[model samples]
Target chain A: MTTETTPARVTVGTGDPVLRVRDLQVSYGTPNGDVPAVDHVSFSLQPGQRLGLIGESGSGKTTMATALMRLTRPPGRIVGGEVLLGETDMLKLDEKGLREVRLRDIALVPQGAMNSLNPVMRIGNQMADAIEAHEGRAARKGMEERISAQLARVGLPPTVARRYPHELSGGMKQRAVMAISTVLNPKVIIADEPTSALDVVVQRQVMQTLGRLQEGIGSAVVLIGHDMGLIAQFADLIGVMYAGRLVEIGPVDEMLTDPRHPYTRLLIDSLPKLTAKGKLVGIPGLPPALLNLPQGCAFNPRCPYAFDRCHQDVPAVQQLAPDRRAACHLYPANPALPALPASVQMDAATPLELTGPAMEGQEEVAG
Target chain B: MSATPLLELRNVTKVFQSGVRKTPANMTVALRDASLVLPDGTATATAIAGESGSGKTTMARLLLGFIKPSEGQILYKGVDITKMDKAQRLAYRREVQPIFQDPFEVYNPFYKVDHVLTTPLRNFGLYAGEEQKRIEEALEMVGLRPKETLGRYPHQLSGGQRQRIMVARALLLRPRIIMADEPVSMVDASLRATILDELRKLVSEFGISLLYITHDLTTAYQVCDDIVVLYQGTVTEVGSVEKVIRDPQHPYTRLLVSSIPLPDRTQRWGEDDSAITEEQARRSTSGCRFAPRCARAMEECWTQIPPLFRVDPDRAASCFLRKDAPVLPSEQVGQVLKVMRPGDAGNAPAA
Candidate 1:
């Protein structure tokens, strides 16, 4: 092995975080106004930490993934934020500097693995391209071995290096993407729904492979998806996003068992359990549209625990305990989230009337 | 409650040919020797649970008469579906309704949401002077206000609303059985529970049997009474959802049940699972489809195909581990109950 490609050994969580985001904001420019997709989001990732970001369809989890890497396309602009990659501000980096820092330090495993790979390029060439772009040209034999090894690391056989993207199955294609993204041993890997299209068996296997890879390279991973069960199983810390804001962020055990935010609690309660079968409970009303949000909190209309103060002023994210933070008016005052009212809990089993004044605002946007 | 079954699939097999000419090499067995029965007068929900390419959709399409089965028969109330007369076919069409997977694609863009509700009434010639009242009642059954949901185009409604409208359309038919194909898969997470609750209400309040086909086992366990676990194109396990999910007998079913990521944090998935290559899966057609990936595979598992073994009075699993259990008769589903009872034939191996 060449000295230039030697793997670096860094102690995990002993020093500064590998990635830190401060008041990040991303907006989509429209004719009416600039619609915020990721609004004032802030978080940090220690070395080897696995953070799973989850939300509904329009909750902007995927947008957070793209904005973190500065890959937001036209019509969507990174309005303001500081994405610090070990003190290097990514937003301030020039074009060439940004490109160099992307795969070399932070890599992105995009949402759709089927369409992410270049159709015309061979699998080996794609791996070689990612490697050659970072480090100049290398010996052909060594390059081939490295490519085969990378594919094998993700559980793909050496023969996979000779095949094209179409020749692989859905699970294999996702593994190939994982292999390519981790070829450089990136400090932070932003994987967005890497296993959405896969079945349960393959999804489990893919998550296992991702876990093994992260342990091998000691890289922090930001996994973004909509499945709470999958995220709870994989992530060390869970962050809930809603309407362009980070609603809850804490350790997985604390987040699932004793979630502080009403939206987080509703989202967790909505999942059907295998151990107990009961009436399926869902959050009443739909998530508000970003363009026409409510007066205070975006989730105020759907929140079962919303009080009078929640409708008048926005609640800033407050630290409830060490390593736990939630953006809700109930926290910092109440020691814990109070039990949901019996009437509100009953409404979860029954459908809400759309004619109610609280639901009228959401109906207009939904209609 | 009745002697005859509402709907039945008897040894049905469907194969699709890919090449221009008919050949065994290019044919794909979408469904193989599947049999199920929805007894008449019972409102139980049976879930056909499987992963993608496991032939759950093929079973649904075969029941809907969208495609003909290659080998066996699909019967509706003691008569073969393909042999039904015009009047019988119309009755079948009116009694058996379908709730498609994608609610958005089922609607026409140009028509208002009222079009879906009115078409069924006009088709059955039930649109007397109470057309408005009937539509309103059906909509109210699924918990949708008739005023706001009517007169709106498909694009103007949310996914949850559109799905509720589809449920209302099915309810208007007063169907005996509704084949809901992945009804809650496309909806948002928070809305999924609401839709599932509505489906459960159909069975309790309206006395409608539901054939729920889906790849999600959690939702299936919640809403279904009995479960049929399909692997590839074959039935691996079938029983009460409670018993089957609690103690899965088939190797594939066990793998599927264990693979589901629960919301609890104390239980984490182990890294011991190893995936089989596509080549191995394709080559093991002569034997069990899961033999290549089975952790307890024996030498005989590679060549001999196991029959569905009667493991319980109401349960059956196709696996070599239950070899001592009696083979379930495949001819008639009603005969299955008579062939084995609880104490008379206490020969089934413990799960």
Candidate 2:
């Protein structure tokens, strides 16, 4: 079931990269000072590729995704960043140019499906409005058929288009939202915690629906969520974020099996296993406050491998391997510091077996 | 296990009526003939596992005396709670306390967080000279420092810290039973293990029986000793956590176990809508509540409700498939329920 609407202006060729974000920095303006929510974040998405951005609350993963679409509101400004959608610099575009780029080039499947749709409007009209806004009034002809085909692609019945948002279940509403977002066939789709509020069975169904749509449109997807297990299942590449910075980015298999960053390791270890055998230990202390971030590495206070240099100098993004990057003092890329012993490096690769009273007093070090 | 139960719910049922003019069609059955027993003289953790509309919260509220059951009795120490005297009720209130789901909503934002800990001590008249020591001890037990959490407001502390304070407040009363309703659902994944470990320690060290209610199957496996799988307020299966997870007898239990997304990368869930459709048929279904959704449902399952069939020496499931003999009438079902009591002698035929 394909929509009859013609494709909008195809700026980039099929083989080229869809989106690129270079050294993006976003800050929230507060009464005290500017809080750097996303500092020096850089990543790119190829056509039909899935990149999962994971982090705990207050980690600025949502802010980073919002900045990519140039949707960061007032008080939260894109202080420094270049969001490149194909050859176009998204940051430099005017409001009208950005509007044209939205839905035609990149679309957003918002966090809460309930709040995304207009409650007063019917589902079909809301979808038609999205199409009309992008494709103009003449494109609204035979809109019902296009809406139904898009809805059917996501496994929703055509009758759902006539119902109001409140008339549908949470899962149904989410599917409708997905259909509307992808009806325009955007090159890139950003789904922020798309299935976070759903039940387990429904969550899997929604994820499958999103996967099917992304495959159908051949759009690059940026899936942001906190569930590491869910992300590992769906995403091809995973990026771990902590306190607004990209701590580690690598292939999904490499990041899950042999994580280099201490924070990523802790996040994976914290997931409860199906079979209850050993005790799961959470990382002690809370995520650092963006307003009063600690000196040097932000994760140094909670990191178990902290040493002398970790307290003094901020770690830059260093290439750990061919396709992996980690920002940590332990993997110092420069030749200035002597390389750590092979035994110490091997210990970093293995999962830490935390026990006894060692976990206590770790929170006290975080000023 | 002791002969007397710390708490018991005998054939309890709750029906919530909606709309201005309440009719039979407007009525929603939250819980249906549900029975549970928490054994005395032991620190046991029993988890009531289910989805959103599974009536876990209703069961917790029924036990707490916040709402009375439409039918049947809730017993405390083998005595009906509704018939208790003023003095007995006060004692019962102290014995059964609740740890709510959201820590932030449980406390007021205007007051200091320590007020949650101090109010109970003051109300129970335990705020004496050693009040500070008791508060500090309770906080330490939950792995929170008194100095760090004493003067802060609800907004000042993290979600994990706020939840720990709630646990600390429960400890101050020295309660025998703690009803934690999805306590760690809102907490972060990293911090969930810490809170769960604290709840388990309370059972082991403090001899406090915990009624842990959650929709998360993984956490249920981690902390619960016994598990009760609730589907639309009906007890579909009940047994030791290991038995229920490893060898589930009921079809609903099998669906739930399979639906849990494990950390293992190899296993993937197949597309299935039977479980979801069964949940949607909850309000209108008659006979077996789970029949509409059960993959192995029979024709008789749509007309007659099934009784709890003993699947093992310790496990019981409400399913027609488990019944070897003829279906029993409602009167004979009472006899079956009596034998199914936690510490009762073996009076029924075992699987």
Candidate 3:
């Protein structure tokens, strides 16, 4: 495949993008058939830019992130797409090449501190393992010093290095995991729900630690989480996913404040505000199963403003504004296609009607 | 107001004795002098908001009569629940229903979802004729269709659907009070509002008092009329949700309020230096539990446990900052604990 570098208006450092993903497709082979977990997802990450992939469970956000690193397990395969990491097409790289790319180029801070760390190993041994695996065995002389330095960077006491995973608190373990992931200083870090399990105050501290670490390393971050509030606080750009597709991607402020997509609007509305006056209304139905997703737009069944076009035709991703794109019938690329009725156009000021036919437990499931 | 409360915990203090040989160090003070009342004849919702190990679970367990309080009496309609007979205990169980955090745990994976609804009906001897209609009505009340949710295994339904089914089961009992412990925590954010709305509707429409237990202040603010902020198992602040959230007097309450990541992008967490290390905060067992972490902690705050000082007529915060203020007696505080409206300052206590 020919590598085409699309010029982004808001480049990170005035050069080719640091990490560019094009037409990424990942599918899970179930007993019934092949289910497309991540279908035609594409996004670019500029150097040091924080892109938050916000979605509910089973929305394929995690699958897409894992697929980028080629870390997808059995039954889940990356069928298509180009994962270009600074001129290198990562998809084409072999096992040897991928290993080098994984540690040196991109690292992952997996979800849950408890599951991520090796229970039996000391914190120092875990850090050393990553460093030794990537930087080679000869670099062991200064490994202890490097580990302590990284630990301190994330606000963990250097004495914590000798302690086991269970010995440290949840917050400390989380910080240690972050330290280990960033010990090598990769170009991009993908932290998946790093603080979801922590308390609010502890979560704040962890987020602060992550922000400081990200700044110190100057690496592009792909933060995946279910919390829109946390994502809005941390991310510069936001991508909203629903049913194995990237519904919308734009600047975080613009996307959050004035989201074009109905799903994005619903997510924002669903969030219980500390300062809200009235009761919050949730989106009516569950997201469609990936195996038997609804025809045309996957979100049509749950979307309050879904029209006839949304039911029959898949909405192509259209550039709604500069540096902003959304896949919805409302924002059609073609001039001939009619936009959604003005009455149903959801905005911050207008409250959406909760009762709908779709909300009455009429879900279409495919066998 | 009635002289007797629907349910009440009088100076409840629970200590969990850990390990084979119990020691003072092993004894975890889950709750310390925690007192609250659920008023009868009105569908008032009070949120027990606290983080893990803050004793929200212990309080819930005490309310459910699963475990006896090490000290203090749990009164139901002015009767001590601890001293209740088997017959009285059964009645209490029927009236006070609990909705736990994980719906999957409440349900058996092998059994059909309908079993959850039918089991309660069968046990209560209400499954003679109108079982199907009653089940349908209960499901409808929680925004679920009987046809869609019934006869399906636990794995077939979503977390939100499963949780709603749990609520539907609770509704079947026709309980006077429903204690929902982190009901929406495991459910998706999109589905949380619907569950919360159902809980709120139960209060208004069905006149069922809800004891919403959660760590998330956002949901508590949305559904609850009153807020009880817990720190290290102690009631840090208990007042109208508006008063507690809008102008939090307790330092811990303020930290919790500010720490929540709002949807607004401009809002950022305070500097790291302002926050106490988690280890330090958790280790301190003396004085004000929040004193080590509190930015405004005075020397007196470190050595003295602050009493529940009345901030206003309807609001009380346990903080040394309000130490100089007039303290309302514990007995009087419970009687006058009316839900205050947004701007309804009946009488302003001098600060």
Which candidate achieves the best lDDT against the true structure?
1
After superposition, the stretches of candidate 1 with alpha carbons farther than 4 Å from their true spots are: A1-12, A139-141, A348-350, A353-367, B275-283, B332-351
Arranged by TM-score, best first: 1, 3, 2
Q: Which ranking of candidates, highest lDDT first?
A: 1, 3, 2
| TM-score of chain A, all candidates | 0.92, 0.87, 0.87
Interface RMSD of each: 7.2, 9.5, 9.4
For A23-103, candidate 1 gives per-residue lDDT tens digits of 999998878688888999999999988899998877888888998899999788999989999989999999999989998
User: Could you tell me how far off, in angstroms, the CA of residue A167 lies in candidate 3 after the best superposition?
Assistant: 1.2
DockQ each candidate and list the results. 0.47, 0.26, 0.42
Task: List ranges where model 2 is wrong by over 4 Å.
Answer: A1-15, A332-367, B19-22, B274-284, B325-351
lDDT of 2 by residue, B213-293 (tens): 998888887877678889888888876767888888888888788767665556555555534453444634567887766
lDDT of 3 by residue, A1-367 (tens): 1111122312543456788989999998889798887888888887778899998878888888798788999799999999899999989999999988886889888888899999999999999998898878898998888888989989887898899999998999999999998988888899888888899889888887887787778788899888898888778889998878999999888888788888898888888887655656787777777777678998997787787999889889888776788999876544322444577543321222222212211111100
Clashing pairs for model 1 are: none
Q: Provide the lowest-lDDT 10-residue window in model 1 chain A.
A: A358-367
lDDT measured at residue A316 in model 2 versus the true structure, 0 to 100:
92
Candidate 3 local Cα displacement, residue A154, angstroms? 0.5
TM-score of chain A of 1: 0.92
Tell me the tens digit of each residue's lDDT in model 2 across A1-367. 3211122212212466789889999998889799898999998888887888998777888888788889999889999878889999999999999999998899998887999999999999999999999889998789889989989988888999999999999899999999998888998999988887787767877887888788779898999987887787777779999889999998777788778888888788778777554565677766777887778998877777778888889999998876688899878544322433454432211222212112111121000
Model 2 clash pairs?
Answer: none
The count of residue-pair clashes in candidate 1 stands at: 0
Q: Candidate 3, clashing residue pairs?
A: none
